[model samples]
Target: MIIGLYFWNLLRNQQSNKTAVDRESKKEMEKLRKLRSIQLTQPLAEKTRPQSMKDIIGQKEGLKALKAALCGPNPQHVLIYGPPGVGKTAAARVVLEQAKQHASSPFLQDAKFVEIDATTARFDERGIADPLIGSVHDPIYQGAGALGVAGVPQPKQGAVTKAHGGVLFIDEIGELHPVQMNKLLKVLEDRKVFLESSYYHEEDTNIPRYIHDIFQNGLPADFRLVGATTRTPDEIPPAIRSRCMEIYFKPLLPDEIAEIAQSAIAKLGMPESPEAVRVVVNYASNGREAVNMIQLAAGLAITEGRDRLRAEDIEWVVNSSQISPRPQKKVPKEQKIGYINGLAVHGPNIGTLLEIEVTSMSAEKPGAGKLTITGAVDEEEMGGGARTLRRKSMARSSVENVCTVLRQIGLNPFHYDIHLNFPGGVPIDGPSAGIAIACAITSSIRRVPVHPRLAMTGEVSIHGRVKPVGGVVAKVEAALQAGVEKVLIPRDNWQEMFAGLQGIEVIPVDTVEEVICHAFPEWAESISERGESEGNWIDPSIEPAVQPILPFMQARSTSE
Candidate 1:
């Protein structure tokens, strides 16, 4: 009875152990089944995901290239280049969308696709290469003399091997180092696995070729390589760029920007107005920024329970996002001054040449004509501008001041008018240009042909003293480029002028009186011939340092 009981108890223990093992096994099998179901369902859903070419937006030029590559007889490897978030990657996604459609035919429906980030893949030597080409010693290759124990060597399948019939997308292609790029290029060229056994020597000759032999001929010629980067082609290495068809994606226009904003609103299911859309898009500058800002605004609008997006909402988003240029104060006109044209005389560093056109001329004398002045003047600062305008205005206010000085000098002209302009819309700011602008204006108003080759930059004080300017080198270069023959700079900048400064004569000036004297030599000579002593002659063009009045010009102001 005891022996029978012992046997029965042992059997029961065995039964309990088997039951536990069976339950655990069943649970594991169910877990695997769930995993398998998830794997099967994920790809099916991903395939059915809505993607269409027509709905794609931005990158018109890139789209054309993509169409040509995917639809043409010989598809080329493509590289999309642009600023960050300007749709280089999105353009690639669009291509993949089209490629997916092309691959859906009965013959090609099994085509596979692989997307890899070169930046992440570059760190792993084995990981990167193993994915593209299967490992040399894969299970199928082990313990084979001629072949594996199965008696036949099989080709190891890699991701590239898997992707043989379809496209491989590489994002941020530029981030790939030279070695990775070269490896990728090889893979792109030959779509199959090229395996070589480095760890062990082959023991048999007749195994029908190693599993690595599949990649011997290089990648399958048909596999497509799609690469996208934010860098220009010039920035990319020549070896990699040589294999790519490069395309430039330009910035979106205002209208297209608006469209993107509208699309974002629609995607987010928010009601937005055209004005609000414009406000948002213009604020964001690009599609990616526009979308992000719109998303934030949409969330805010929904959270606040607003039915329609108001301009204030957009403003709030724009302000909160800080996507706009900093606000600049509007300069007050009461504090504003006139801009002096520096085109007449070259100022040291702070001024530019003003070109003058005379429209009207009338004079007290038979040959004289009334003169008005117009042209462009470049200057550096508002303070300098104030002094320059004041000097020019004072010169203009006293017709006698100009006529007496010019006629005594015999540098006379009939009734004249002067019109001035600055080429780059650069506001002339400085007192230095007062004398130069006055000179150019006087030359036009006097109907005298001021030497066109002569260009000058300077600051004129209230009393007509020529003071130094800044940016002498840049001003000189500008003058030289503009084809000016002579650049008259303040004497102070003579040491600073570079030795290589070329193509023009650089003349230095000490005082406004000296420039005027040179401009009106006849007057200077006549005044000298007079027996009047130097003490008796008050130089009309002398600039005084202590003058309190500043000019009425703001040449440096950006907006006219």
Candidate 2:
């Protein structure tokens, strides 16, 4: 009976241990279930990102071109050029989805979008591993799997491999390192990424067929690349740029910013005052910035227990966030002496209305007048005055060119001390501001006022000719936004067609003389007098055949 009881006790112990194991397994699964139930909070920008192409704002033309490329039977690789926070990545993703619906498109239903920022991408130079292309994880690596640990090589798929038959979107592609970029270019040409490693042996008995296949035949990376960069076309490498179709996204206008703000507010199920919306638009330059400002304002309002966003809330948010208002210097209603409005473009799309002002005083010594320029820093030297002057070589050269033209036109630049200033201390880099600087100096020296409503952009030659400048369309748009009534561009830019220039008049002039005629009409009588006596000058507005010059004796006799 004791022997039977011993066996029974052992059986009872085994049963209890089994029951405990079952209970532990159930508890672990319950914990996992609880963890799975937890939800992640998404930012307002991501939550409000457009899922459909039609929902995207402020880039209708770009979207149309993108759609054509993505939805066509033979889709091409693309490069999206634009400023930050302008929906390049989001647009790329949505276009992929839309392409899947088109029967003619090559994209499959399961086509994926694998995105990476080149700014943060890590690459292995030895070809051991690459995050963009597939990498070979050798047996020595810690997580190379049990098979790999047992002296078999393993191939790890990367973004390029995973995005096969779909899109691989690289943000800030211009920031990519040259080595990695070369590897990517190779993949682009071959449509496959080859894996290589000393640890990988084809004849190994333990090697998986898939691993062997990957090592022998490169992994498929036949995916379309959609690269987004904030850089201009010139900044991008020629090889990559040549392979892709480029699309540019313009900077958001004030009205577009306002509309984006309203949409974001509605998505948050929050009410915002119209004035508050306007305030956000005034502070933000792009749709992304506008949405972020609105979200910040909404958060402040929510914390205060206010149901609707107030202008005061926006103001508080702006102050707390340190968001500066858009630089919109009020357009002078009346002409001002020595001050002229000049237009400048920052990048592909951003344009600013710059105010160039000139003031002159009699020099301490006759014929020893000096030209001092401010508001531009020397790029070569980072320190003070002389360096600053050197940094503004373009501006200085422009001033010298203007002086040459003045000397040619019978004005002595050395008779007075000339001080040129670009207000707000903004660096003047390009030659596009040449004509405006000349106009400002002439107005200051001649005691004439330049029309405040007029803004001009063109390069001024030493011969008083106005040379054509790039970004004329952008400059004119900026002038219109700044409430300027008229813009004077080079005659060569007259062929450039610009949309939304209804209220503003854009006059094309080939010479500084023509610009002065339009800008300083009050001095028209003086200009006519000078032109008549100076055989070199001709007023383009008059017929050349009608104005006959008389010989010295004949003219003298007629005057008597």
Candidate 3:
């Protein structure tokens, strides 16, 4: 009876121990659930991630292209090109969700969207670990866990397989490694990913049936690819580009930035003043940047116990961050000789007004004249990894080109030594400066003021033709921001001009004489008042100025 009592006690203790273990596991899981439910503080940018297409700003055309490419029954692989923070990733994410709702879309209800950053996606050389493409794990890493195939190889699916029948998004796809990109192209073509393992024997019965089948018939990777890159189209490999339909997103304008900042403030449950929003717009270059600024400013306002976001808080944030405001090159009202507003593109798409000025004084002796160039680099760039940064400067060559054009138009560059200066010490380089350079020099020579509401960008030929130049859209944007009312682009560019442009007149000029007639409005007006056909394009409006250079002009013209 004593032995029986001892056995009963032992059984009771074992039951108690098992109960304690169950309670411990339950407690741990409850704690885990609680932790999971606890929401951590997220950045304002993350908090405002676009859940719908409407939430994304300044990317209408890009989003439309994305939808058409993915929402159709026959979806195509896509490559999205744009500058950073301009809604490339946001568009990619939101488009897939919307595409799933389309009746004709191929994506099923349970279709997945797998995203990986080519910049961060880990890649291995020996097929040990490739998150982008499928890799295999030899028995050594598995520690021989599978039944019957304890010492055999196991196939591991990567993002490609996981995203099967859906979309695989790769941000910064241009940064993908060469080997992986090749493998990706192969998978894209075959719609399947083949795996290999040196340790596996197909005839071995120990191998899992699934593994054998995977080896025999590759895993299904019949998914669509959606790639986002901050790189230009040319930077991407032709092989990858050929397989995908390309889309471009333009840089965000200041107004769009303001809109985003205001929306972010509203989302943060903060009232925003227009000035405060403007401050954010001035500092923020894109949507992500705008939200980031509003977030910090809102926090600072809360710390100061202000219910509404104030410009002071924004100023504080800007000052604390040491962030420089966008360059405010307001158009100058006063007319001045030897200075003209020339348009030049800076970075990817940001355009700036260049101040090209020329101060001409007759050389100490005739025929000893020289053109001095400054603040312009060699118009050179470096290329590697199939990338090119084109930088061209008409600093010297275009100036020389202008000199030739000037001679043809009856301006004696040799009689007067010209000192052309592109002020602000900013490196100014492009293929050409419009006849604006010639006008500035002519302005200095004739002491006539060029129009205040004008900006121009185009290449000039030696024979006086206004040839086409790139970035006409960006140039016009810069012109508008500077409060300029008119811009002169190459006539050859009329077909490419941006439509729906309000508050600015885009004049397409064919020859230097046309630029002369338009820019020297005084001359144009004088000619118009007299009602003379295109005879002499010289400025008869330069008072007292015509005398100093009239002799040189007549002499040069008569001689030529």
Candidate 4:
């Protein structure tokens, strides 16, 4: 009996030792649990925030929208659209900051601000359901299950729950696929997620090891959704577009650009000049591009050991970064050559009529003089007017030949400068204007005044065809504007003249010979006399030929 008692006492002592050890282990675990709870209370990693509202540049309009939304009872879904670097993303962040500071009874107190890049997060199936709806039996919660002695089942919480009663910002929201968008729509409409599941079967333990309802049930999703994108709403799903508000982002104005420049200067600690700032702003292709270029230039200056940005520095950067405007080429000098005005008239049946202004000579002294010409005549442009007209090599040779012809007739046309100008800048390619130019030069060179009211339009062929031209009306109109009384058109074009041709006398000519004879009645007396000689041929209806010569009778006037 003594032996039995001794053994029993030893057994009891051993059991007590085991109990003490179990108690110690339990206390240590309790201490560890408290320590872990303390650790989790620490705040999350910090994120950089915009310093101020004005510090945020490039989207004044967007900032305005955000402020309005925060101040007003109804917060509209804001959609900002523009090219990249236009500050679509930055403006949204600034709105959040402004709301926190100035918004009364601010949404920040209850509204959670959750930002997700739609491009990355929406398409991710794992991330999508995981965030919007709580995950089932998440691996992270397995430890809790193992530690819970009751073996109670639980539903895992997600970011959507975490962001409950807050704003959710989705950037690049246009990239969301249709299915993901549908899910979002559901969340917006339902305003709550219903999670149904059996935590564990009763067979796991007679005491019901797991609870039947494990999720955080009936959680209100009073979150506001704010999204941003560079794409248009039309590009997004129609259903999605219908639900959100869209605002177009316009380019910043000069004043706004200046504000941004100054802000950047102050923020970056870079030296800037007003002139340099203007140069950057103007040289930039657009507002945002200008800001980016300015940023680059400022950074470069800092590295290059410069203080104030010089004009040359800005110019250099602008030159390298931007395209220069093209240079304007110089127009060639006008050559004293044959030209066709719209007024030059061709023969009647041929239907060729063009107003031709003949610059007989450059009006240097208000008189026709000898001319010098040099250039190859383009033959194809001559048409059939006068195939026999020879292209002369020199202006001097042509002038001398004409002078010799005029001298043979005893009319000395000299001592004047002559000029020929076409109405339009079309190059005078044919010899049609040569005779008219020659006659004008002769009138000026002789110091004999031609009729101021008279204007001649004719084409001189190389062989002197006196080709008829087209468009006599326009030429006559031009001559009339120049204060001309009578217009000489190709005889062919006279009948073609409309009833409206009453203002100017339309003296028609069949040939260049007629023009010369009519133009220089004093020089060609026989032709003028012959016209008078044939009484009826010289129509009395026609105005009398004007015969106004220089007042001075001497061949070489005293003035000359």
Which numbered prediction scores highest in TM-score against the true structure? 2
Q: Rate the local accuracy (lDDT) of all candidates.
A: 0.55, 0.81, 0.81, 0.52
Tell me how many residue pairs clash in candidate 3.
0
Cα lDDT tens digits, model 4, 1-560, are 99999999999999999999999999999999998778432111011123467655555666786667654555555556554545555566656655655546345644566777766663334431455455455233436555344545455555556667556777787787666678777767776655544544535553332333333334556566677666644466667666766654544444556665555555555655787677665555334555565666665787888866666666777778764531111112331223322233221111122333344443345335644333322233222445644553332334444554443333444543334344433333443344556565555454444554556655544333445655455456445544455667666556664445666677876544456566656745643443333211222234334422222212222333
What is the per-residue lDDT of model 2 for residues 278-353, given as tens digits with 9 covering 90 to 100? Answer: 8888898888888888888888888888879888878888898898887766578887889999998877666789
Which is the winner by TM-score between candidate 2 and candidate 3?
Answer: 2
Q: Which residue pairs collide in model 3, if any?
A: none
lDDT of 1 by residue, 65-173 (tens): 7777755546567776655555655556566556555543221556555777767753335432344445444334435444455444444455555556666677787
Instruction: Give the range of the ten consecutive residues with the poorest summed lDDT in model 3.
Output: 551-560
lDDT (tens digit, per residue) of candidate 3 on 414-529: 77888888888687776558578878888898898888888888888766778888767767878898899998888888854355578998888888878888877666665555
RMSD of 1: 18.5
The 10-residue segment of model 2 with minimum total lDDT is: 551-560
Cα error, candidate 1, residue 297 (Å): 1.7
lDDT score, candidate 4, position 434: 46
After superposing candidate 1 on the true structure, give the runs of residues whose Cα lies further than 4 Å from its correct spot: 1-50, 96-110, 126-159, 199-221, 324-560
